[model samples]
Target: MAKEFTDEDDALLAELGVEVETKKEAARTPREERIIAGFEEIQRFVTEHGRPPQHGEDRDIFERLYSVRLDRLRAQPDCLALLQPFDHQGILADAILVPGPDEDISDEELLSQLGVDDIAQNDITELRHVRSTADKRAAEEIANRERCEDFDSFKPLFNAVQKDIDSGVRITRPIRKEAGFLKTDIRSGEFFILGGQVAYVAEVSDFFKAPNGESDARLRVIYSNGTESNLLLRSLQRALYKDETSRRVSEPSAGPLFTGENEDNDLASGTIYVLRSKSDNPIVTAHRDLIHKIGVTGGDVAKRIANAKLDPTFLLADVEVIATYKLFNICRTKLEKIIHRVFDPARLDIQIEDRFGNPVIPREWFLVPLFVINEAVEKIKDSTIIGYMYDPATSRLMRTKDWA
Candidate 1:
């Protein structure tokens, strides 16, 4: 008669010297057992597929098979070993957890207290690992998007901006303060700001057609303020170049300098500065122009634009929207498509007239990130893994169950 083993018995047999029977049983009831069972299932699945899964492909498989009771299974050492790679190291400084001296517990005790048998610890650890990896990957991706071939050639501002993106905040173009002066100098680029920190983007050149009865030439702002005082291309270039003395800026110092605005030109009342980058590293310094008016219009629009330019809120929002729609599709693909159609008109209506005689909303075409806070939080609560796999373009997450 074939030997019969209980779940604990099988684990014990596997732990001890028992081989043939335990190995055979491991193949038969892999997915049914707790802890190592998920890993066995994964190994079997990989074997069935003819090879080991490559990097992120394993994560997809782990997310799918474990999603059933992931919160319960991930804490097991055996399960975590199979799911997480040995060589993987966290990039973010905060993710690297080192026990403090104030704590009475030792490292081993701290690890013990985390309840390796419980799923929460593994889930938290795994999430941190994934987040750190995503931060590194996001930096690489953003660089790729910007077509940066040399890391050294990339600007320091780019690194600063990415740091903000990882934290789920908006990036803002950096601004300089003058002693006892209310003057402001704005930096050029698309950015987001969250909670005082700014996610700054490198300035890219784009041309805008002349507005009605405006100049015939295509006006461009190397950087846009998202409101009035959007500088023209020539104007921005002039700001970067040396004026008056006709001598170039010495020792590679870049900063903003205010050029008084002409009220007669219908230009907004503010000072403009020639901001320059001094080092081999690209760092933009904003010289805030002194504004004659304060709180004239509702602060909402200005606040939103400023924040959006500096924080990861935009990226987070995109992630949430994508994940939400994706979950909707997984649950009811057909119905969701219909719903999207119903909502299409409302989205189309949210447009602003542009200088090119076309509709342009900063969120839609200005290449800025749009993050809706509540929606992101909801999506994260719904599916943690899918929430991370958000699509920037559509702001949606793909569902594993839906694919299955």
Candidate 2:
């Protein structure tokens, strides 16, 4: 060991033009070291790929892992700052990592987040006791796909969905952590992204409780690549949760009023207009009384709908203004949400392509009779609409039950 330098020795060294060495930073903790190592591996991947790793079922395993690791690093500024010195690729600026984690990411978790599993037993930095065998098998079940013999029947559906997304009828939203109760959203005919592939829930069996007592069901999931898996609903939910870049593909719905984005900014300055579509479509003609377009606008109702036949919202035909309720001091957007929520179950499920051949899901059209609409308006006036929901079976507004 070197002798301790006294103040006299320090002064003598300075006088002799000698420099004393000092530490620039505190010694890194094991966690910080691991974080840095993980990030360096990701940097290596970036160097080899010439692009940052991306999320997709079709991407290479290591690339996917690097992508996930990059995501985690970006989310933690602390991790990013810590990794800055090692960031020779300038990835730190673009979530390439300028961080050190404020977390307890164990070796197993780190490996899992990087989408690594098969090599866990070999002990990556002695990742012992990190993953259990049963859990490993369960995770493997998600990726084990079989040839889909009936994929031919689903091919047209997939093609249609792709078209809808391309035309703005459907949208894909990031599967956020805060998306409450994901399993509830997984129903028959729903689509999701898992392992970077488009997944469709072709069927959902009766719900049963797992060992943990969470609700689960057997799902016949079909993939776009002609493979299928009979995975449990809980498995899909867990996969979605673990995959940071996973997304939920929304169903085709009447897209924009083609104009709600603009009107959403307007305040309490519009009339609640109810109009009837005069389209010759068999269904519209048959149930014309039950289907009405409800909307709010700050401009004249007649002037607003000057060219109804050209607009998809009016069902590509002229409309008759059946009723109009003048409003004062009411936030039109909030009222529209309330109305939609009240009659959500009664919403008319119709998809019409516009002149541009883009799929459009019309908004604000409900299957309620005229008298019910009048009563709903009166409730809005008295602020009693909050306590009611439109009941199509009973043909009236029923008092909403407070489950909470």
Candidate 3:
């Protein structure tokens, strides 16, 4: 037989500081349902805006409204008996103790602000108690952060950069290898249909010339079949952007979600930009120098890009590799890590299961493993600053390191 505890038992247990009280089981009534509806509305308001009800008069009025529904519950023997096992005073004591929603955006006080009547729907006390305590904490954290102007000061720049990256054309790398046989001709250059030109292809080269007075950076594009096409620095840039956008859109959204970096570090995520220019065999690639100036420590790939002397198609592929791997690291390490240190530690355990039903940690954790790597990167200050020179005559991308 199930043991039944009296209201006095509930009071005694609560007085002893028990964490929870027992209540008799009974069928949920309409009054209970109404309470749930009202509570849900309150919850939604709080979640979206972040406002808590006032403690004194507002709370008292809310309880009064709640008791009207409880009156109905009291009429039912089962419901009343269920209540008998609850320490009502203790249960109701802190019922309205949830934190205020975002002080700025929370419209939680909207109803009161408009002088609306305190309407009673039902008693939602039980349902409200069922919500996880963690949810409240998380909500409070989100609200507080959202209210901090400094937290998202980069909204404009961030939005613009996101749009630029999102709007670019996607380019995918053609698989070159299959079971002992090369899938695509590595020697003859494939057509990059966008520029509508047949350029000679060449191996990825590293001997790019730096721009000088009256001279421009030259990006040599070589076709697979020993054919070649020369592109000015700007044209190469445009091609890189086109390829990045295309590849980004085509790739499925993997779970390593990207977020904006911190304010302290002016460096944000790296974006691939494509600038179009008409100069052929343009000398000096300034893109490398520009990133170098921006504190980019890993430019071996960029140097290799300069060396490849690739045609448009090959250059496009190389850009994808450089942007995805090298530049990606710049943002994740230099920017995101610094910002993540400010993340609330209490919310660190937050996670969601992937499609495979495996618990996956969020992108924030990726910084943890790269701490040493980032420290090493920051040490190479010379290679990471913006030290590029541009020449209008030849439309060149110039760098001192590549110059004599």
> How does each model score on lDDT?
0.29, 0.74, 0.32
- Residues 202-265, candidate 3: write the lDDT tens digits: 2234334445433333444432222334444434434433332211111221112222344454
For all predicted structures, in order, the TM-scores are 0.18, 0.38, 0.17
Leading candidate by TM-score: 2
Q: Which wins on lDDT, candidate 2 or candidate 3?
A: 2
Return the lDDT, model 1, position 378.
32
TM-score, model 1 to reference: 0.18
For candidate 2, write residues 257-326 as lDDT tens digits: 1222234453446788899998888878889988998888877899989999999988888999999876
Q: Which stretches of candidate 2 lie over 4 Å from their true place?
A: 1-143, 256-295, 299-404
Alpha-carbon error at 353 in model 2, in Å?
A: 45
On residues 1-404, what C-alpha lDDT tens digit does candidate 1 reach at each position? Answer: 97677788877877888864424533524333333444455356445544332332213423333332332333334434444542132111112232233212222233243322333554434432233554443322212111134334335545644554455342122221211101011123433331122223344334344555432221222111121222343332232231222111111111111112233434332211111112121111121121001111112333433433223222111111111111211223332232233223223212333334564433221111223222323332222222123333454433322222
Q: Which model is ahead, 1 or 3, in terms of lDDT? A: 3
